[model samples]
Structure formats: structure tokens, C-alpha cells
Target chain A: MLKQVLAAGLMSALVAATAQAQTPPILKMTVIATLSGPQASLGEQVRDGFALAVEQRGGKLGGLPVEVTVMDDELKPDVAVTKIRGLLESSHQDFVVGPVFSVVMAAIFKPVTSAGVFLISPNAGLSTFAGKACSKDLFVTSYQNDQPHSVSGEFATTQGYKRAFIIAPNYQAGRDALTGFKSRYKGEVVSEDYVPLNQMDMQSEIAKIAAAKPDVVFVFLPGGLGINFVKQYRQAGLTNIPVLSTFTVDESTLPAEGDAAIGFYSGTNWAPNMDTPANKAFVAAFEKKFNYVPATYAAQSFDTAMLIDSAVKAAGLDHDRLRTALEKADFASVRGSFKFGVNHYPIQDFYLAQVAKRPDGKLQTEIRSKVLTADVDPYAAECKMQ
Target chain B: MTLLVVQALNGFQLGMLLFLIAAGLTLVFGVMNFVNLAHGVQYMLGAYLGVMFARIAGGFWSGLILASLAAGAFGLVLERLIFRHLYARSELDQVLATFGVIITLNEGVRLVWGSAPLELPMPDALSHSFQLMDGLRYPVYRVALAVTGLVVAGLLALVVNGTRAGMLIRAGASNQEMVSALGVDIGRLFRMVFGVGAMLAGFAGVLAAPLVSVEPNMGDNLLILAFVVIVIGGTGSIRGAFLAALIVGLVDTLGRSMITDFAHAVLSGPASSRVGPALASMLIYLVMAAVLAVRPAGLFPLRS
Candidate 1:
């Protein structure tokens, strides 16, 4: 009886040993996103992007067993700090992803970087981090928040728009937008007005814009504000002048704006109609899986996952080596050839995109022309990441 | 001068919309002592229904009527089923219950209408903009919105102060027991009050639908503004609501534009761009604080 029991135990032990030998170490990752409240759509896009990468890789990243834990930060900055801290302490993950809004990302910066986690930001690129606050542990898969606006400003200048007007919500991103516009455009700013983040009534502001009648109007109202502003602008009969904005009118908001958004122009890093295999494939699989167009948030997040996967392969799970591998961002991006600046933010191509109705009869972003072949951030010089 | 004229008209138009919402909110709270935080959902429902019906009936007028009727009916049904019980409950209970209703309705609307804002097209006749000044052209639809708002304010004043039903409502607001002792069907009156309040908010939603994006919780910020109007105007007083709403609206609209210009003139370009909006947004709240400090009760506190 003792011999028989020993044989059965031996067989099970062999099976366990073989399984352990095959799988080195489970790659554990914690993702924090603003998955609820006003910013839910943005968070959802990030989540899906990460999920798509995982699925395509046969549920593994870099050929290692992986576990992903996601937490919604509830669109609250303070709440994000707590969630990030909890994940760092409990999950013990060396890699962390997301929290889309700049405010939330800024709030959790200390905890995330302090914990030695590789903070892969899918969105929310702040100038603070891109410049003075840049950290070895921090990595952004998207442009520094100001770059889109900078590209648009440069595009505007190239188009010979002499007199310009800028409008944005009174927030960190908004200030950065205005600052970015000023960086490139050597023109007289006729008016630069900021409104409350939730200011719905743009009638008076629209009136002021009409009265000023700059050669072009630049705005940075994202989410619902974008839809409201565009519609109100149309209602005010201000369609004669060209409107330029970034993160304002896109696939997510274009549908909301209906016909009012038809002629709107914006600078972006990725659009569904980009003539690239990576973007085309990403869009097709995403539309098939989610039945909606992926926004810029999703594009960056997908890049983030792919970047991480490639980095892990190149550097293994070691923190210092991983950071080194990340700096050399060698991966095919949906927006095409990816390379990070010394600060760990992308220096990639940006396109001037216009809102146009798709052949499918839904409004989508159509790339008009290349804003730049490969753009480096203005803040990269300040990023002393050596 | 033209800018001033345009801004004043904008404020007046905004004020009228506030009064329409506050009229119903104040009357319901005044007589019934029911705190309905879900009142805002009625406004949202009105906009949603207007969009659906306007599309179906192929015009704006039919959409407005249908939305108003549907919203009033929805309010009446809710009163019969849920609010009737809360009337006898504690004030906190009423607030809590209504808050729950607000959450449920917001989610329900999102499920039904989707998160994308639906376009409610203005009738072609009213869609064009007319010259308010050489450079300033205002939409005829918006002018219609203001005129309709003014007319509604007048009708509300007449209904609440001069009419017999209005008198009963006033008596109930002042002394509910006395009205009940006089054999008034207070429950029936409660239904009427709730329905009318819902209808008025719905009407505003219908009117504002063409201008604003119609999405779930669109009434949320405006609801806060409506509450402020009632508080500043004096709860349960339509006259106070009208005056206060006008004050609140004018201050909110003109203050935003004027303050931005003033800040730009006083501060550095970038600094003013930052400070201008922050200060302008806070101006209304500052006014509310100042008004409350002086009045204690409100600008026109109702005599209980």
C-alpha cells in the first residue's frame, strides 16, 4: 500500500514540475484607467486596446504567461492615487498602465514612479512630466499633450493664417494647447479665451469669435464640449471662417456633432483611414470586435501594449534593463514607425486630418496630409533623462 | 456697444430658460415639501422625446407638444407610484429617493438613447440667423426661445398668483393643514403641481433641444443652476424665481465675456488667458454667496 501511494504522488509531482519548468514567471501587470463617469469612453478605449493586444498574442505577451488586472479610477484624481497605490503594494506588478486624463495621471505620478513600476501611459501626456518631471520609470506611448496643438499651429502657419484666435477650457491641457499654438505660429493672436470645463453655453463666446473674425479659429474643447461648441458655432453662422482644433472633433465626437462637424480640421497622430497596414489591420479587428471606430486613445494604448511586449522580449523582466529597452522603442506603431524621445515620449509622424463622412455613412477622420514626417517634442531638450 | 447689446440679449434669453425650470421646481417644493432631485431628469427626458418625436412627426412643433405631454405624463405616473410615499417621509428620505431616481433615469436614458448626443434639427424656417449687428448675427430660433421663455414667465406669474388653483397652491405652501381642513383634494392638487412642474421643465428641454446637444444627464449642470435660481429667488415664489433667474442668467452670461476682456487688459496675455476663465466661471457663485449673505433666506424669501 505504501509503494502504490508513493507512485501516485511521484506521477503528480512530475506533472507539476514539468508545468513549472515550461512557464518561467507569470508576467503580472496592473492597469488603472478612468473607466467610469464622464471620462468612461476614453478609459474604455484604452481597455479594449490592451485587450486586443492580449488576444492577438494568444493570451500571452512576449511568449510569457501574463496576468492583467484592471481598476477603474472613477475619473477622480484622488481616487486614482489610492487605486495606483493599492495596485503597487498588493499586485506587486512592475508594469502599470493607464488613467487617461492628465489630472488623474498627475495625481498618481508620485505613487506610480516611487513604486518603481514602469508607468506606461496610454494617454494623458502632460508637459510637467515631458519636461521637468520626466522619470526613468515613466513612459508615454502617445505624444506629449502639446504636440498635437503644436503640429496644428505649424500647419496653420504653413497655410498662411496670419491672424489667429485660440479657445480652450481652463485646464492644464487647455493652457498647454494655447502655449503650443504660440510656439509655432508667428501671428497676431486676435483673442484667446478660456471657458470653464463644463461651460455648455458657448453662445456669447461664439459671438465674440464671430465678431473678432480671425483668419482661423483654434480650439481645444474635448469630449462633450467639442460637440456643443461645434454645433453652436454652426448655429451662430460662423462657418465662413476655418476652425482648427486638436482632440476636439474626432470619431467619438464627430457622430455627436452630426453635420456641423463636416469641414472641421485637426492635427492628429493616427486616423482609421491612414494608408498603413498596422493601422488598417488594427482598425479592422477593432471594428469587428467592438463594432465602433477606435479613437486616438485606443491607438496609443494598443501601441503601449505592443511596445511593452517587444520591450519585455528584448530586456526580460528586469526593471533597469526594461527601462533601457523602452527608451529604444523598436516596434511597429499603428501611426507608423515608433521611436521615443530621450524623455520616453513618442517622436512620430502627425497628420492633418479632417472630419469627413465615410462611405459607410458615419463621420470619421480622413487624413489630409502629413503635418510632419517625424516630430520631436519641444520639451525633449528639458528632459535630462541621461 | 453692439457686443453689449448682444450679451444682454444672451443673458435675457438664458434667464428665461432658467425661470421656466425654476417655476416648476419651486412650486413642487413649496406646496408639497418634496425635494425632487430627479426633476432634472424630466428636462432630459423632454429633450430626448423631442428628438425622437420631432424626427418621427417630421417637424419641430409636433415634437415639442408630444415631448411636453409625455414628460407631464411621466411625472404624474412617478408621483402616483413613488413620490406619493416620499411625501410623508422625512426630507432626507425624499432627497435620497429622488437622487436614486436621478441615477436610474440617467442610466436608463443612456441605454435607450446611447451615449452619443442626438441632433434635434430646428425647423428650416427658424434655422437662419438674422443680423443683430453688422458683425453679430443671432439665430432666429434663439430669439424664438427667448420670446417663448418670456411668454411662459408671464403665464406662470398669472397662474400662480391670480388664479384660484394658484391661490390654493399658495395656501398649501403657507399652511398645508389649513388647506386640507378646507376639504381641498390636496393629493389631486399634488398630482397637478408635479405634472405641471415636469411639463414646464420638459418644455424648456424641448425649446433648448435645438441649441444644445441632447444626451444623457444634459440637464445636470442646468439643474444646479435651476436650484440656485430658486434659492436666490426665494423658494415657492414664482415672482422671486423670475427675478432671480434673470439676475443669475445675466450675471452668468455677460460676466463670462466681460470678465475675460477685463482680465486680458489687466494681466499678462498668458496669465489672463488662464485667470480670465477661472474668475468668470466663479462670478455667478460669488454673486450667489453675496446674495445669500445679505438676504439670509434669499433675495425674496416666501412668507410661511
Candidate 2:
């Protein structure tokens, strides 16, 4: 009954788009995300954020009937590839939004782009694509993977940390993060520990962190890995060492981390507490609809829709026109300011943020200050976009 | 010296958790000749249950007992409803069915809990830290885990060796047909073993909830490790599982920590970074391979 009510509500909401469809039928925008499994929260945020954008636009994009269909990859690469193929075959002219997680996105990159569907990533701006593999067909509304680490590393250096330790899940993104940090941090990296990607328990690694006694600990754990690390780090009696991380302490995992995440310094491109009008509206709308503060994934996804909407207005369903329109980046971003890099990824400000207790006793991130302004990803230089 | 000790202690704590799950698995496999792939979900459920019960009971200790009871009862229900039917089937059939069970339970838990991880708070009494050395301090929760693991192992050994039920279990594991031919109700015995195994796995989950992030599919990775532990420990032998769990845990924990440090000492930073992570993943599988090569039936195969 509830699902039926939701379906009926969705139908009523899509009435404007449906009526507008009489002219040209429907302009479909398929969102591919992990709608199931452990990382479903991230996917849920993207789906909801995108839906909110569409709802605000009254289920239409650029005065055209827009039908948004979300597919669940279920955290499987094969499933994601299949979904992309399905979308390419069916909705060939529309923009495909998201399939988060750098690894999953990397799997379907070639097929989706080759099929001539405009791929807009809501999250996971993989560095591999940002550099040499830059494609003219793809646009990332999100910051490149290395942006946070590089900016945070700059902050670490400014704070005068001479000794540093790096710990991250043993994955491609993990390697990229540590490399990005080292590129900016001119310090003696005392040790580097790369555990398995799925590893949750890290007492041994925590013990090693204490033993090494680095001036600062920079961790690259995302999802549950970050939660375990933060919780155990506090338990290990190393809270004074000042751990810095990216993609770790955000709204999605902050509540679960509870007191452990308080005062934890992180580097991010977006925060819920951003004072910009667009950001404030997005957060307020998200809270009203979902009864929870929007995380970076949701914020970036909303930005993706807003960006796509700008291009759709300039040129409806024309690939070349949309590409040209996107390059102009005429959309009002929730991040206050945004621009496109040579590689088509965001050239945006990265900021230092800290987890703070709200007046209501809930934990949320407060942006401290801008760390890097108009920072294009380091790999943008290597990209010769063909 | 300090680093090594800490790593060893960490390894031991992890091994104890592995043994808790392995103890029940080996018993089920040995006695009923049933391979339960869904066992890891049992552990996952235990963690979730611990969180739920703790929240309700307002104490971790009460939550622990309640979670174990709930897990054990759930296991028995599963055995009666599904597993008993598969006992007469081949291992391949049992494996497929249990794998299905794993998927269903994983999805069910996800539906109930929502994909976000549920945090189980550490009891205030066990939330303190203990000084291991002059400069090194270990979390009191971890010390409690290690101690509880040891105590559980001891109590398990005592029950399996000293009690009549233990003798029946050992007899059944060695030769189920002969034990049944002696006029014992093998059905009842099988139910007991299955329920106890589930309870043990759940207890591990409950203990581990405060340490690891409790979420749906949390047990999937550990399932592989627990299987390796029982295989190395010699299936059907609790003593073997205990020994093997310790070795597997120590090697895994210490390998991840020391291998890179050792590599860096011998090679350049970049070279060590490349070699260390790759080697750490392969380290445990290497041990398992060596063990299988040396003792195909494991180090302490149950006598028939």
C-alpha cells in the first residue's frame, strides 16, 4: 500500500513531464547507482538528491518531459556494465547519471561513452580518467579523487607536520590518495600501511600507528573502513596525534562514528553547513524530504542534475550542443563556485572541515576555510582531451 | 619488541574470534556432514542482534546472553525448516542451498536495518584502556575480547571432553552411522550440534560488534577466513581449530604490519609500497597451501 501510494504520488508529480511528452514523447535520464547492499546509503542519497532536483523542476528538464529511471548495480561491476548497455540500447539520446564508487564506474566507462550516451558522474571522479584517459563525452560534477587529499596535504604542511604516516585500503583509489597526499606534503612519510579493501578490523595497524609516532596520520579509508578506523583510533589512545582524512568523516558515516568523529579534521569539496543560498536550499529541502542532512554524495548529485539541466536548456537532446553548453557551466552550483577543468572535471575550491556537535547534539561537518582556490586536479595537465 | 608484541596480541584476539565461529562450523560439518555456507550470516545476525538487544536491555551483558539465545533458537529453526531436508542430500546440494540462505538473510537484514552500519557501543566498564607497557596502551575492550576468547575455548574444551553429550558428539563426528545404530536419536543430536554451532558464531558476532562495524554482509569476508581456520585446524577437531585459528590470525595480522616495514628496510619506499600490499594479501593463502600440502586431512583429522 505504501509502495502504491509512492507510485501514485510519483505519477502525479510526473504529470507535467507527461503532458510535455506529447510534443516529442519523453526525454529519459537514467540514473545508475548502487541501490542495494552495504553501500546503498551512498546510492540512496544520489537517487533522492537527483529526484529532489527533478521534483523542484516539476519532473521536467529544460521545459521538456524528463523521465528519470534509477537502476541498481548492487555493487557488482558486471551488473553495472549490463545496466549501462541496457541504457545505451534503449535511452540512447538521454544523459546517464551516476554509478558511484570509482571501481564500479571504471568498469562501465568504455561501453557507456562509446555508445554515445552522455555520462555524468554524481560521485567518484576517478584520477585515471582525469589524466590521460580524458574523454570529451564524459563530465564529472564531482571533484577528482586526488583533490581532497592534495588540499588536505597542503593543510598538513601548513600546520608544520614533519612526520606523517599513510594508511588506506589496498585499492587503486587508495594508492592514488596516498600519492596525492605525498605530492603536496613535503614531510618524511615514516610508514605506509595498505590493508585489504574490505578489511574492517585494524587493531594491528592502529598499534603500528602508535608505535611509529608520526606527527600526523593521514588515512584514506572510505565507507565502513573509516568508521572502524575512527572508532578504534579513539580506543587506541591516539586521539592527540591529529588524524587527517578525506571521504571518511562525512554526514553518511558521521552519526555512526558518534563522539569518535568529533573534532576530526577532514578535507572535502562540499559541506552541509555551506552558507551559499543554493547549498542552504538543497540541505533544507533534503532535510524536509528525508529528515536527514545531505552528505557529499547527495550534494554532488544535486549539482550534477543542476549542471545537466543548464545544458538541456541551451540545447535539448542534441549531443554536440549539450557538450558545448556544459563547457559554459552556466548552472548555479551549491558549492558557491564551480568551473570546468581542461579535462571536463570540476575546477573548484577544496576546504578544510571539522566535525562539530550541533546545538541539537547531532554531529555535522562545519567548513573551516578554503584551503585551495580554483584547484584543478594535478592530472589535468596530462590530459589531451580528444 | 613492542611492535611485535602488540601485533601478536592483536593477532591472538582476532584468532579467538575466528575460533568461536570455526568451532561451531567444524562441529556441524563433522557430525552431520553438512557444509553450511550461511554460517557467516549467523555471525552477522549476532552482531545486529547484540546491537538491538543492548539498546533494549540497557546493558551489554544482558544483550550478549539474549543475542546468543536468539541466534541458537534461530539456528534450530533453520535446521528444522531447511537444513534437515538437505542432510540426506549431497554436499553440492547442501552448499547451494546454504548459499541461497546466505543471500536471502543478507538481503533480509539489509531490508530490516537499512544499508547503513549500526554502531554497537562499548560498555562503559570495558571501554577503558590498559597499559601494556611503559608507552604502549591497549584498549580494555580488546583485552576483554582476548580473555573471553580464552575462557570460552577452555569451557568448550571442558564440555566436549568431560560431558556425555561431548562423547556423543565426538562419536557422531567419527562415525554417525555407528552412533545411530547404537539406538541414539541421531536427529535430536544433529539439532543440538547445529543450534550450538549457530550460538557460537553469534557469540563471536556479539563480542565483535563493539570492535568491528556491524552491518549487513559484514560476515561475508570473515566467512572465507573462518573456513580457512577450520581447514587448517583440522575439521571436526576443536583443538585443531583453536591452534589453526591462532596461526592464521597471527600470520595475517603480523604479515600486514611487518611485511611493509621489512620491505622498506630492505628496499626503497616506492618499491616497498608496491611489494608490501601485494605480498600481505598473498601471505595467508601461502600458509593454507603449505598446510594442505603437508596434511591433506589437516593436522588433527578426527579418528573413525
Candidate 3:
């Protein structure tokens, strides 16, 4: 009787081993996003855009079944570090995607990459990471922090604006914006002002702008600051002077900005009205599924998923093999004509977008014209990536 | 000169809004001896309520009135349910408890209103800009906001200084035990003060909503400024709060507008451009520190 019982256990073990060998290994993923607070909508776009790609793939990426865990960073760097430390100890993930804020990105990048796991930032490509600090394990699907602003700077020059007024919040990102704008525009900056970060009031600043009387105004205020600035700018009767910005008037803030953002110009990598089949489908499916227009945050996150899928298919999750495959970036991007620089940041076209009310009564940015063709971040030359 | 005048008007508008918020904060802190850190949440709730009521009523004026009433009612509910219990506790406990209230309400608004900002459209009559000079134009809505704040200030002054309740409130601030012993319903008086204070904050929120983005924690920065106002003005003294608000406002606005130019005169252009705005941010806090050094009890201390 003992011999028969042993024989049955051995047979069962053999059968289970064969079954496991026949099936693909499951991929584990963790998404760290700002899921709460004022910027939650941006994080939601990342979450939803990634989820849509996964759902379309029937819960698999590159012939492997996948399990995804989402952690809310709450837009706090300290909190994100703590959560990431816990994640590293408790569970091993193949990929960590997310963190919409640059502050949170700076916090979580080291912990995730030091653990030998790939960290993909769908948004918030801080210049700090794109330059001398570039890591093979860290990938950014979004443009470097300055690229969009640079697009506006170049566009301003093309529009024959001889003098420009620039303003941004006084922070690292704000300084980056000024540097970016200065790098491209040949025009003279009449005035540059940096207000306190999170300052809701801009009346004094607007008065200064009125007094300066520059041909164009460039601002880098995002989220609620953008809403307040745009509304007040319109109210100040400065519509005659064109306002050029990036991430200031986008799908995320357009609902609150309302008519104030109409005809306002922003620089971006992709807009919903792009004339590509994949982009059109993605936009339609996104709006249908999420009940709101997809922002560039969503588009970049979607491409991040597609990047993973392509890389996994080529190299099958082996650490070095996957790194090589990701560097290749063998996939059709929703933005069209996408490639990675030597530093693993995106090399793509930048467009000038204008906010327009769609026929369906929803406001979205439409592609006005392509401003940059296959632009690479200026910091790519500083990267020593092998 | 025109630029300076426009900036001054901006400062005045900001000052009036600060006054409305500080007025409520001073009354509660002064009369009840309660440190109510959640006072800012009342302003945020006012903005949220204004947005909601505007959507429902389809007009800015109706929304403003309804939101003010609702904010008062909500404040009374909070007072009766959570605050009154902590009134006699230590200041630290009141602070910790009210701070928790801020977190809960901030999260509650995110859950209910979602995290996106909601805007209150400018009323048509006030949407247009009025020319201040040859090239400078100011928004009519902002001018109207200052006027409304002045009117409210006038009414608040009358109620707090001239009426029977005002006398009772002054007595309560100086000595709550004596007022309670003299047969006044101190609990009822506290509740009334709390509600009225909340209503004033809400009124400020409604007025400022069109000019600013109405989102969670929108009141936080202004709350800190309001605290500074009350501290510099002398906590519990309404007149002190009014003067301090204006002083802080004009100083802050003008400082922001002219600091870079001022620095350019004294220093190199590159150094001044970088240092100017940073100095402007520190300007108000520097003023607060200066005031505290001179008068530890604040500009207008209530005799206790």
C-alpha cells in the first residue's frame, strides 16, 4: 500500500512539471502613480491607459500572462520611497511603471533600479536622469522635461515674435523651462519672472506682462496654476498677445479652463486629432472607455505598455536580453515615427497644438502643425550609456 | 506709475479676501480660546459649494448666497458634532483634532468632487475688463470682489462692535468663565460665532472662486497667510486683522512686482533676477518676524 501511494505522488509531480513547462511564465508589474490629490487625474490617465493596453492584449504581454499591482504615490516623494521599499521586500516585479510627478520620479528611481528591476517612467522625464545620470535600467517613454518647452520656443521664433515675456513657478522645473526656451528661440526675452510655486494669484504678474507689452508670452504653470492664469489672462484682455505654453492648457485642465483655453497654443508630442490609424483608434477607445478625452499622459503611458510588449516578445524577460530589446524599441508608437536615443529617451516629432472644442462638445487639443522632426533631447549627448 | 497702481489694486483685492478669512479665524480663536486649524477647510468647502450650487442654479449670484448659507450650516454641524467636545481640551489636542479634520475634509472633497478643479464662471456683468490707464486694464470681477469684501467688512464691524451679541462676544473673549457664570448660554454663543465665522470664510471663497481654481486644499496657502494676518493684527481683534491684511497684501504684491527691478539697481542683473522673487516670498514672513519681535502679544491683544 505504501509503494502504490508513493507511485501516485511521483506521477502527479511529473504531470505538474510538464504542465508548467508548456505554459508561459507570468510577468509581474507594479505601477506607482499619484492616485489621490489634485493631480490624481494625470495619474488616472496613466493607470487607465496602461490598463487599456493590457486589456486589449487579453491580460498578457508578449505571450506571457501578467499580474499588475498599482501603488498610489500620493504625489509625495517620501511616501513613495517608503512604499517602494516595502514593494522591493515583499514582492519582485519584472517592471515598475509610473509616477507622474518629477519629484516622485526622483525619489523612486534609485530604489527600483538598484534592485535590478526595470523602471519605466511614462511621464516626468526629468533632465537629471536624461543626462550624466542616465541608467540602463531606467527608461523614459516621455520627452525630457525641456523638450515641449523647446518646441514652443522654436515655434515662437517661427511665428516672427521678436520679443517674448516668460514666467514660471520658482522651482527646478521652472528654471529648466527658461533654459529650454532660451536654447531654441532667437528672439529677445523682454522679461522673465518666477512666482512662488503653487501661487494661485497672478494678477500682479499679469499687470507686469501688460506693462512689458511683449509680442508673445510663455508660461510653464501647470495644473490649477494654469487654470487660474489662463482665466485671468483672458479677463485681463491680453488675448491680442499670443500665449505659448506646454502642459499648461491640456486635456486635464481644459474642463476647468473652459472657453479661456480656446485658441491657446501648447507644444506636445501628440494630440488627439493626429492623423494616424493607431492614434485615432486609441483616442476613440480611450474616450469611450474612460468618458473623457485622453491627455498626452495617457498616450505616453499607452506607448510604455506597447514598448514592454515588444521588448518582451523579442527577448523574453532575460535581464540583459530584455535591456537590449528595450533599447531597440521595436514597436509602432501611437505617436508615430518613434525611436529611442542612445540614452533610452524617446526621439520623436513635436507638434504645435491648439485647443479646440470638438463637434461632440468636448474640448481637446488638435494638431496645428509639426514643429520638430525627430528631435532628440540636448542632454542625450551628455549620456555615457553603453 | 500705472503698473504700480494696477499692482496696488491687485494687492487691495487680495487684502480684502484675507480679511474675510482672518475675521472668522480671529473670532473663533479669540472667543473660544480654540486653535481651529480646520478653519481653512471652511473656505475650501465654500468654493466647492459655490461651484455645485452654481451648476444647479445656473447663476453666480444665487450660488454665492446658497453656498454661504450651506457653509454656515455645515460649520454648525461640525461644531456640534466634533468641535464642542474638544473645546475644553488642551490647545495641542484642539490643534491635533482640527488638523485631522482638515485631512478628512480634504480627502472627503476629493472623493465627492473628484480631484479635478471646478471653476465658477464670472458673471457676465463683471466679466469685462475696465481700463485703468492707456495700456492697463483690470478685470471688473476683481473690482467687484473688493467692493463686496468692503461691504461685508462694514457689516461685520457693526455686528461685532455695536450690537448686544457683540458685547457678549467681547466679554466671552476676555473671560469666558465670567460670561458663563453671568447666565449667558456660552455653548450657544460659541456655536453662533463659529457658524458666522464659517459663513464669512465661505463668502470669501465664493468671491475668489472665479478668479482662482477651486480644488482640494485651495484654502491652505491663504490659510497660512490668514494666520499671519491675525497674528500681526493681534489675535481676536477684528480691527487689527483688517489693518494687518492690507499691510501684508500691499507689501507682498508690490514686493513681487518691483523686487527684481529694485535688486537690479543694487546688484548685478543675473544675481538680482535669481534673488528677487525668492526675496519677495520671504518678505511677508520677514514682516511677521519683525512684528513678533516688537510685540509678542501681536498688534492688538485682547485683555484677558
Best by lDDT: 3
Candidate scoring better on TM-score of 1 and 2: 2
What would the per-residue lDDT of candidate 3 be over residues A1-386, giving only the tens digit for each residue?
99999999999999999998897588999988998877888999999999999988999888788899999999999999999989888988899998899999999999999999999999989988899999999999999988999999999999989999998888888888887988899999988898998687888888888888899999899888899999888888787888989889999999889888898999999999988888998998898888889999999999999999999999997989999999899987889899899888999999999999999898999999999999999999999985
Model 3 chain A worst lDDT run, 10 consecutive residues: A197-206
Write candidate 3's Cα lDDT for B187-265 as tens digits: 9999999999999999889989999989898888888999999999998899889989998889899999999888877
Per-residue alpha-carbon lDDT of model 2 for B176-245, expressed as tens digits?
9999999999999999989999999999999998877888888898899988988887888899889999
Interface RMSD for model 1 amounts to 1.7
Q: Could you tell me how far off, in angstroms, the CA of residue A170 lies in candidate 2 after the best superposition? A: 1.5
- Sort all candidates by lDDT, best to worst: 3, 2, 1
State candidate 1's TM-score.
0.92
TM-score of chain A of each: 0.93, 0.92, 0.94
DockQ, computed on Cα atoms, for candidate 1:
0.58
Candidate 2 residue runs with Cα over 4 Å from true position: A1-21, A384-386, B134-136
Which candidate model has the greater DockQ, 1 or 2?
Answer: 2
Model 2 / residue A293 / CA error / Å: 2.5
Models, CA RMSD each: 3.5, 6.5, 2.8
* lDDT, residue A366, candidate 3: 94
lDDT string for model 2 (A1-386, tens) is 99999999999879968876656746777898998877888999999899999899998877777888789988898889987787678655578888788878898888888888788898979988999999998999988888899877898899999999888888778888998888899888888778898886888888887777889989888888999988988888776788889978888888678888887889999889999999989998998998777889999999988988888898877889989999888989999899898899998999999999888887889999889999988889999987
- Could you give the candidate ranking by TM-score, starting with the highest? 3, 2, 1
Model 1 clash pairs? none
The candidate with the higher DockQ, 2 or 3, is 3
Question: Against the hidden true structure, what lDDT does model 2 obtain?
Answer: 0.87
Cα distance off (Å), candidate 2, residue A226:
1.3
Q: Deviation in angstroms for B231 in model 2?
A: 0.8
